[model samples]
Target: MTLRGERQADFAYQAVYRYMINLINEVSTDTRVKLPSLRQLSQRLNVSISTIQYAYSLLEKEGRVYSVAKSGYYAWPLSGSPSTLPSGDLLERLYVAARRPGMVVLSADEPALLASLDATLLRLERELVRQHPRHLQSWSQPCGVWELRAALAARYTSSPSRCWHADDVYIGADLRGVLDILIEVLGLRGSTVIVESPCDWLILRLLQDAGVRIIELPWAPDGRLDLPALEGTLIEETVQLVLLSSAVSLPSGVAMQPFERLEVARLLEQYGCWLLENDTYSELGFQPQQAALRDLVNPDRLVVFSCFEKILGPEAPYGYLLSRHMSGELQRQFLLRSFRLSSIRQRAIARLYHSGQIDQHLNTLRQLLREQAGEMSQRLDHHLGDQVTYRMPSGGATFWLGSVHAVDMRQVFQHLLARQVVVAPGELFSLGGLHSQHVRLSHTFHGQPNLEIALAALGEALRQAQLG
Candidate 1:
């Protein structure tokens, strides 16, 4: 073959090969991902048609990708996975993940921690110059920055006490980083992971993608996991880690009651199992009176993850994990995957958090959300008597919703989307049949124009979907 031909082939192969690796990481490994058509990809990437086809062929030969007759190339479902996924210092990954298309993220329960950053930007710049203008030039050292970690410890503000130290805190860039760290520290392979039924879609998708066997702990009204059902599932499933939401469970917005947490923590401690507390939405609370699972117990079995995305908005890039023991291996994995977030951002976050605007905005937002959420709740209540079920969280931004079984939420979703009304479908939360009759509503018609009008349109769609 000519050198030009070989070179073109190699470039195409490299491109397609890279795409496959990213596909596995970005999309789930347990599911099939439709690859773009050769012509489509070529047009988009400014590559030649033959190159795209040749690249796919090379990937197919190597078992990275496959093609079905009469169908397009698709990335093969992965197992355990290769080291092809990019490893960055964390900041780069954070920037990139934040920029992805359709990330219209309303899934994780991150609070808006960066409002402080906005409020403090001018002063923060001055402080940076005064304290350490060359901060960006410095490399992140052992145990992360002391001040940043200390700020994180202070930010958490646990009810009883801070169970962690400034040295104990390390900030990564969202749920993904926290998960990677926990997975590394915990040695999760071949281990059963427990998730609540109707949990965060991304969490479900991530664990599902990793080939993790999942046990759906029943999430009842009081944010209590159905004990009998969970015990039976645990015995039957050999659950290794129990992912609980102490402060703010995503999508559901239900915080585990203190008593329920005490019971669950005891059960988990007895089993010698681990609990991953996702308090990502903890900051959404405006009330001074709320409990955290981490606060109620001191068991070595729990690791809590909280992030800064929900209220402050997406790509704000900060997540922290407080564990009983952070192993060297775990730290290694975090440092290795650290490409997803930046120390610069973490540094700024430390400064902003210290400035205290996050607390102030959170208070304002909490009051606003409480009032708005109540309005929406009343609207939902008025519309559907038993046709819909929802959580009226004492605090936090999102809530769990269940609709009448007769309502095919998918159809309702499609109909509403056609009408430009966006709402999270219930199936995203459940393990199929059980949650098919629900939809979580996070946005309320608080300020924007025609709020009631849009909701009415969606309500009509719901009526049709249910009635039909």
Candidate 2:
């Protein structure tokens, strides 16, 4: 065959392989099920029989399927694929497991609290109440308390290309609420959006619930953004939005360099699509200097979503949406649907920012997180060694780990849960049943006494899963 023909054949085989995997994930139960025969699959996919055979052979080699003497291929028993579960259900199960007495949770993505702000917050809150006694009875503006919005706006005004003002900011209690409003205001229901694979599961759930069509673009083997695939999708599809983290992507923790962000900005601009940049982990990046896509993308086309929860703990349930070019109608709709946050808390946070305490806290928090990540990496090397493989994250609180050999991570999760440890299976981060051999372990519990024990338990669980 010619080189071009070989390439085409390879593409065809890959398509069949992916299709078969999805099909098996959707249909497989506790029992092994027969897959479509080679001839039938070839006819259905409009590919040559040899291509289907090759695909099946590869799956068999990967232990995802097996062949009978003459009956044909059969899918391996999935034993209840976790990816098939609803996102809410899976989350609830994990939450319940984490709440068990004496449970060591390595699955939670929430950052650890490095310092207390009780005294500072109390002082600010008291001052606010004392200064304006009558203001307590009035509700804050729907957009947010003016002082907090202004304080937040001041931080982003450094970009000379874009003028950011208080009006460009909208504050909410959490990222979920902010995202919900954006989805509604932008009229994104049923529209196509591109997201990174192995992304934050909560965001995936939100997009799914919003009735939006999601096309997942995967990272390259070298842990960089797959620019070619992204551009090709932009060329072939009418994507309304591209949602991604510019720094420290969740689960994977791989960050895009400045050059990559520039290329991404260029593609989004060329395609005339909106960029919903998730900057939740940008501040936590280990790099001293981080470049934002906002600097490269047109301000009119970019909307940045960020939250303080990762840095300030759940007690501070504050998140803000920043966009200078939202249409008046869209902004009006957002305000109409949004509820007001606590005026006193917002003022207190603004005070924290004004006093530069927030900056100090962030600096300390980043240093601690960096140290914890390094210690976790060293422990993983000491404990799991060659049994698992992972990339040390550039920043962020979690580690994405893949088993060195084929091992069902769902079973590993269960095994660890039984031993009073909780872990997040890779299925939680994907929809297509990929990454079944991977798991996401957070470093939030790094300083706890049980951390080493939890790691040992995890190693044992992987061993058992592989042996089974």
Candidate 3:
């Protein structure tokens, strides 16, 4: 309402509004609709918050965008979608749904035994003190410390035909950090990227943020990759990249079989596309194998992303990107971005490997997880068997549950949260916004007794929702 300065700001806002309209028109699909954040757009367009606010307000009035309470704005309603919940709404809604204190979180993929981290943390502390002087002096190389890389290479080499070179490994701050770098380095924006339907929520978010043309291939009800559907998609279209959680499917906890992986590899080979194997849950599986689908194909055709954050906890933030032939490109990108890791973390992880403490930790974890999963599986089957359908994946931190009826899983999830429990709603995992009757529960968050209670509460919630 002011004079000349207001006029300038109004002009900027109008420009940004037009840019946003063009962006939404170009990127949004009939099923998957994505929109950029106010902060992102403001920065990109060199505009202020007031300008963005005005633009967003105009868009809202025009029905071009809709804002979630505390979350950002969305471009349009996804056609044939089960839920209109935007990714930005997920964290806030989950937080609000948690109505009581000391809530049981069955939605997170955390360690079942928090005490199991004691020894690892102690070892890390010792390593930090030992390397205090060195850590203070310098930053890590873009490719990371050689000691850690060698340790990881040796770990892979122990399994037959899975030997890796230190140079092929590039380390980053964490799982998200490494993935962000890979998406940019690989130039996946505007490329046709294939992912599983009901895939990892984080993966879906990342792909959507990167502006990739996403194609979701539905996984079979048995939790295996729908190979026929995948083959059809591969032959019918040109796919730039395929993201697979081969070791353990996040949220769903399904593990892709070796032969199933081989078939996927064949399709990629036939199509000449890159397969990024997400091995975040690699160390947590039952029958841990060294040979991956990457081993079956031209090493250049695959990239493996794994991190110690899941195993060693979030305090130890480090993950590796193993690209057989893209090391040079990754190195270039690393240098260009000046990405660096803490030398202390690299040393701590290396020390964990050399002292054989890593193996001990993993062995204990595997046995405990297997037992915990068994108990949780039995509890779910006994309590929710009649109301929901589910399968105990071979190895992973979570389980997938689908309702027997056509119910909105977000509502059921919110109901469970109100009852002091939280489970991941299925809508978050889909790019196409399908599968609203499913939910994910992570067994690792609580011990058997508490988990039993959570499962029982979930059953009651389902029943109440159905009746209501």
Candidate 4:
């Protein structure tokens, strides 16, 4: 089926699902409610019977409803009111508060290396503009600067499985923009996607905004991918895409082993699922580069989305999407809606990458991050020892912390916010509201003296909540 047709069909199923949920909610909780029949609902809702069936099947999988042979689907009795998922409203508030002047933002996800690279990037940007004045005379090519695309494509060409070319690379303003284009061009709306539990908040927000259903695959306590759970989910759910950081998972900061990547690749191939590999944090791994999942998954089934923001700093916010199978139509749709990135910045980054300066910068950045991670872990142990639990990050910038005792992280967030400290409550990470007692803290601001004060305050707030 065409992408647009699949999207429309999924939308129909979602409409029917929501309608059923509303209907089920209206009935008494003490008794079971027989749902409208597929034929009846199809006629009533002006949708095909197959759409209704698809909706019912999803509801059955979710345990919202059940079916008996020769009988219509029926709503299961409610145990209590359905729990509300964390809204973007709270996330927005936290983000805004985090950026307030003088606020101690332990919730930051951006790398601290950005500040150190300003002078170098500025110099490079100026040099590019001076040497390439003609770039200003014309609009950037629809696919972005050819040099940039070529440079990016060259990185993946070494993998025999991924014979990527410049045409296969599409650059956008940033990672989020690239993702938005992918969602639109791929017609991911109303489709189901599997994401890591405690996934990137931006990713979760974008998926939710696109009207996509998200299934979160949580990490095992030992910080490994729960392969069995992932396999079970793939078996049970009609998941269209799986989005994850194959090298280093966010929030948790756990790097996947080669075997784990191989297993995930195997499952994705077996289930015929598209993989959106977020390689944004791959360079931050403490150990040597692990095997790439791209080498394991079919090239056509994998789309790599990465950006220069973490490495080159937010000043050069450019992201590229790499896939061996980008169709002409998909490229056309992307060009029509996507913003053109700065030609000067693209050239500058391309120069940086080709000059091998990026590798040198990465080596320095990785060491800084490692030191910061250790410092953050030590501080956490000092202030909140035994009060909160967290896995010391293997890579990436943040720590996923769980309160040892029952405590509402949202409440902690609000409490800390009043004191000019901002924290990302774990509720923002999942659709199921499963991480209410957890919070994601970043080591980005480890060098700041106020970070220690913020951790102390956080420790106090968590202790109070535990006592209450």
Candidate 5:
């Protein structure tokens, strides 16, 4: 009668499946409950994905688990329980993405980097408060504290042609917010916007919500955004903006080459479109770093954005958008049209960074991150060569992997999940929400044996799927 031992020893997977089903009834407060991720439950039971897959299939057949399209499996969506739990599907996804003991975290590209604030910098922050007590008295004005923008403009522009005055810069909630304002002020509604394919999904989602028409440019293997594919679509609409992430490129950590950047500038000028360079990942890469877009581009058509949120963790709230693209009237319209940037949060985070606290920590963090990336790429190639192929990146925290098979990544995803490994499926990063046989994993989760186990489980899953 025990769920542990198979009542019918011939079916080892059946026991696990039934046990999961019964366990759901016992542990779940409501008759309708959510399911644990295949990965999390897989690790806890020391079981392979075959068992979990079989169990999940059986549960789905029996009406115990509900699958939601574009999301994941959940306990019956109508969980009758009065208690509100974080949606099981979301919790399971988070549990898999978050670093846990003996769990694989491949979904994000965060660095395995860390350091503490230096005493001097900490003292500077305190002194800023003591010396300028009145500065903090009011919510920082919309334009931002004048001194920080001056500092930010200096940091943002390295080329003489790109240098900006403090008044031209605006500190906003984040890149999405910045883009929204830029579009509104520029009267960009219904205008065509060009974006790189396999792009940052959140940004694409924003454009979609705004009813902005999107034209996707295919990316070449070297990570160059395909200028030719864009040319075909550019003529159809009044293409006003071309958005790009040139350094530490997301989803694929491929930075654009320097010469290509110069060409990008020239192309935009010819096309008579404005350029918005999103360099959020600029500082988080391995290479020496490329020149900022504005530094090399015609300033009248270029607006550059860079931020600390990605490089220093999302907790670091400060970032700046350098603008020389707007005219006197547009600048006034930008300022007058919208409430000032998220002024207070931007100033505080910038103050910590400006005080030299962030710089000191970054030096040590870079070294650790580089070493960890080496370890991750090595293991990925070793375990999943035939089924997966990846190129060790030259200098970014993330790398790309693809399978030649026509298989949906969801199988690999479920397989990894049973092993507690979570990676962002490539389909989610693709244009049109199309699923692909690829995924992106970050090396920042290195230095842990769980990562190793997860990779091995992935191999087994790939093999099993291939055979079937």
Candidate 6:
């Protein structure tokens, strides 16, 4: 039997709704049993609350469930034999498989230049000896080591807008910590912040856990900023800041157009909202660089942030925040929170930047990533054929793929995980419903041969899933 209002076409919300139906059938052995709350179900299923509500509405229309005004949905178990929900063990097993050491992991955020990291670290070691003993002994000033800041300043001065200065740079050992501090420093608590749906999952999770009031704007499938919607939202809500990834977005690797960035800045200025531009993957672009919002927007209204993890390695993860509107009190607050900085590490990074090695490394890294992305895309196309579709990432390490047919991504993720192949479920990237059949694959972790093997394995898994 088919579900009412169900269509055969692929859509994220429909997929989630169908899954909810199956879940009710699989569970609901007793009548009037309360279903999980929308928030609870959303978190458990990695879907959005709106998706759950839509599914519930459909179920209510079909008389499969009933809702209490202030309570929640409840299943109406029919007499005689009854069906039960799928075992919760499904997701448990999937996460466990993802953790296996030898799994064909495609969700890794590791750098593509894996082999060259050792060489870079060795160079850092060599450069570290040149720093004065006194500099190493004392605590780094809150603004960070002067040499590193100066190096960062030099790099930014090369851009179209030569506004960055040594004093404008602030270093943080942990990117997330720095961001949290920035949010507080900006006095944005209890204020509405706008973020893109399907943004960096880690960042999304961080914001959620921090209890920030967020308004997530759904990104169009084509990867452009929904400006009209954004402006509408700004008009309707009081937004303190807009967190944007202007270079390459996570999962999708889609870049914002140059004009779009400028327009977004203009809108933010008009609405009196600050723009925190995250350009972490900007250096990975394969073509000529596009203009950044930092160059287009008034410096007082825009603060740019990026980390070394993409260019350097995970072991050396430090980030720099550049802002022109920072006040003495704000700087002091930031410094007060971070009493000590890693002087040695800062000096090493400074050497890499000052000696031009950073640029040379980036030139090579970008080419390597481009080749890896190409290999992954070609392999998927050759093996999966029409079963899957994906766009070749222009920058960043991940490719967001959508299934060509109706398939439960959760089941597919499980099947692939059982075979020790790991991919990120699309639902994990958004706060609400998404293209549920979508999955994310990372190309930075493996070389061509291993990538080919993983793709072949994934193709087999897809075939199996389709058959079932």
TM-score of each: 0.71, 0.78, 0.76, 0.79, 0.71, 0.74
Error of 2 at 72 (Å): 45
lDDT of 4 at 145: 84
Superior candidate under TM-score, 3 versus 5: 3
Better of 3 and 5 by lDDT: 3
- Count of steric clashes across candidates, in order: 18, 0, 0, 0, 6, 5
Worst lDDT run of 10 residues, candidate 3, spans 1-10
lDDT of 1 at 85: 19
Model 1, 345-399: lDDT tens digits are 4566677677786666677777777776777677667755556666687566555
Count of clashes in candidate 1:
18
Residue 84 displacement in candidate 2 (angstroms)? 21
Considering TM-score, where higher is better, how would the candidates rank from best to worst?
Answer: 4, 2, 3, 6, 5, 1
On TM-score, the stronger of 2 and 3 is: 2
**Ten residues in sequence with the least summed lDDT for candidate 2:** 1-10
lDDT of 4 by residue, 97-130 (tens): 5434566777878774433565677788777667
Error of 3 at 299 (Å): 0.4
lDDT score at residue 162, model 2, on the 0-100 scale: 59
Worst 10 residues of 5 by lDDT: 77-86
Screening candidate 2 with a backbone cut-off below 3 angstroms (N, C-alpha, C), the clashing residue pairs are none
Cα misplacement distance, residue 23 of candidate 4 (Å): 48
The order of the candidates by lDDT, greatest first, is: 2, 4, 3, 6, 5, 1
In model 6, what lDDT does residue 461 have? 67
Q: What is the C-alpha lDDT of each candidate?
A: 0.59, 0.76, 0.70, 0.75, 0.61, 0.69
Model 1: runs farther than 4 Å from truth? 1-131, 142-144, 154-162, 221-223, 338-344, 382-387, 444-446
**Model 6 TM-score relative to the real fold:** 0.74
On a 0 to 100 scale, what is the lDDT of residue 252 in model 1? 64
lDDT of 5: 0.61
Query: Candidate 5, residues 1-468: lDDT per residue as tens digits?
Result: 343343322133456776777776666544444567766666666554434544665565454664443354566433332232234443244332343333456676545233333343345545555665533445334445666677677676665655777877776534555666666666667778888767876677667767788877756666676766666666666788988875656666677788778888777777788887777766666768767665666678777766555555543334457776564644564455333332333445567657775666666677767777777767887887777866566555676777756665666776666666777777766566543766777777535767777778877876666523
